[model samples]
Each structure stands twice: as C-alpha cells, then as structure tokens.
Target: MAERVAGILLAAGSGSRLGQPKALVELGGETLAQRGVALLQDGGADPVILVTGAVPVTIPEALAVHNPDWSTGMGSSLATGLHALAETDAEAAVVALADQPLVGAEAVRRLIAAYAGGASVAVAAYDGKPRNPVLIARGHWPAVIELATGDTGARAFLRARPGLVTQVECGDTGSPDDVDTAEDLARVRGVATVRSEEKS
Candidate 1:
C-alpha cells in the first residue's frame, strides 16, 4: 500500500498588499483556499488541510486549522499544519501557498514521487529555482516545526539542511508565481487564461 501523504495549504496571509486575505481572493470563480484544496486533492493527496489566519475561512473540501498566532506569519501556519497532522499516521505532508494559485498539481505529484523514492524532503522547482509545494517526511516534522518561526515557513529549516531536500523539476508543470498585488494577480490571471485557451 502507498503511504498516506497529507496536503497542507498555507492560507493564513492577510494579503495586506493585495487588499484582502489571499485565502479569500477569487480566481476563476473559486476562492484561493478552495482552489488550493482542489489542487492538493487532484494531486493525489489524502485528507487535505488548509491553515487559516488573518481571516475566517470555512472550506468544505479541507480541514481548516486556525492559527491563532497567524499574525506572526507563515511559520506559525506551517507549525500548525504539522501539529495537526502529527495526530494522524500520514508519513509525509505536501505544503503549498494559497497565493500561488498557478502552481500545478503535477508539482505535488512530483514531490510525492520524490518522497516515495526515499527523499525525506522534496521541493518543486521551476526553471531551476526551487519553489512551492514542498514535501517533508514525518520524521523531519520536529526540526521543521522548530525552525518554522516568523514568516519563513520551512525556509529556515530547508536552508539549514540543504542536503535533505530533493529539488523536483516542475517548470513544465506550472508556475509558482504569487498574487501578492493586484498587478501580479492580473498577470497570473492572464497567464491562466492563456493556459486554459491552450488546453481547449
């Protein structure tokens, strides 16, 4: 049997620059939080989880875990998601950002594949640069949680332990572009439109 890998979406950002909570932001008629869950689910993750902060979000598709210290940043949300999963038997978890809606499910699949291939840590890379949808094995959760302080999320731990991360090439899969501002969102939406038209 395949190991159970949980999917975690970090949607706690207030998106002060984007003018609203990123999780609540809309793209193609779906909230970022909702779309993020579907991305994980479609990527073959079981029991997808969305970490909510800065705003109240209730998505039927995901188990929303509230981070009371969300104001501190992504680190708290990452810790929150890991703690929530510690209760379960999942061997690993795929962490993603809500603002990066353009990241494809294929990235998640590749990270999971890396994890299955004996890599305890996997990061999706676009155009040779490591990006979102990182995969971490359960054994490394404690170290990750300890380093996950402030807005850095897993970055601190990942940087401290570069040898553990397996960069999965996913540039062909999708973009890790962030919707941090209105202009960025517009650009991402435009890219999405082009991709959709291409698919059709």
Candidate 2:
C-alpha cells in the first residue's frame, strides 16, 4: 500500500491552564511538539503539518507548516490542518495534539493500521474513552471540518458519525493523559521517573 495518510499536530493553544506554552514544554528530553512530530514520522505519515497559534511564532523548521489561528480553538487548527491535507494527495490523516506525549510512535502505528484496515475513522480508545490522536479517512474529513468550532475538536462529530469509526485499544495510561495543568505535568514527570528507575 502506498503512503496515503498525513499527520496533523494541533499545537496552538493559549495554555491558560499550564500558564506557559505547553507545546514547548520539555518532556523526556523533547518538546511536546517535537514528540508529536516524531510519532507521526515514526508512523510513516508523510508531510506532517504542525498547527500553531496561541504561541507558535517560533515553530521549528522541521514542521511543514504552522497555523497562526491556533488561538481561536482546536477547531480552527483542525480546519486549517485538514485543509492543508486536502492539498496533498493523502487518502486520510492522523490528527493529534502536541500535549499528548504519551501518544508515542506505537500508538500512531496502531491508529494507522486500524484505518488502513478499512475503518473510515480510527480513534484511540484509551481507558474506554475516545480522545484525540484519531485517524480520519478522506471520506470523513468534511464532517470533521464541519463539526469543529471554537475550541471544540472532532470528538462530537465523531460521535455523531458513529458508523464510520473503529476504536483501537492503546496500552499506555499516558496515551490519554494530556498535559493541561501543573499537576498533569508533575504526574507525567513522576511516571517518567518511575519508568526510568525500572529500566535501570
């Protein structure tokens, strides 16, 4: 199968809860944005687009393009990213958030695999709850674009179009844990420390 999927990383949030730029926050020696990009790269997605707005003036050169309207909401960023994908010949796209460091390369692989297996949309069902890091087939892109508004993302739209989605299970607890607050960051650090200790 030829590569037909693209990766879209939404990184333009105000970070009001985090009190700083969450995308630039360091995690496991890499920024959240970098980690998100790496996941897409590792998953074999071509031409990943990183959308930024709230604080995206200095996005790294590695990201194909950064949307400055990120402050409007995830929906605007999603619309922008999806539109960018439309320009490409991609059959689908894997949409993710920069704050989700736990959505590592393995998770992305599973998402793409599920979508490739015929799911019009493949979303991560972490802890039995569907969230970001979803794979949207070309046929479902319009719905995704239509349902996005304000800060709202594709969850509601995905829910409305239940017939097209196939949920995939992810093994990591962090896969669902987005770093939105100071406590969330602390928790992530703690988990990383524990994992490091176990490895040693």
lDDT of each: 0.93, 0.80
Per-model TM-score versus the true fold: 0.98, 0.90
Per-residue lDDT tens digits for candidate 2, residues 39-153, read 8888778778888776653445345456666667888889989988898899988898888787667777888888777787898887777886889888778888999988778
lDDT tens digits by residue: candidate 1, 174-199: 99999999999999889988998899
Candidate 1 wrong stretches, greater than 4 Å: none
RMSD of 1: 0.7
The TM-score obtained by model 2 is 0.90
RMSD values for the candidates in order, in angstroms, are 0.7, 2.0
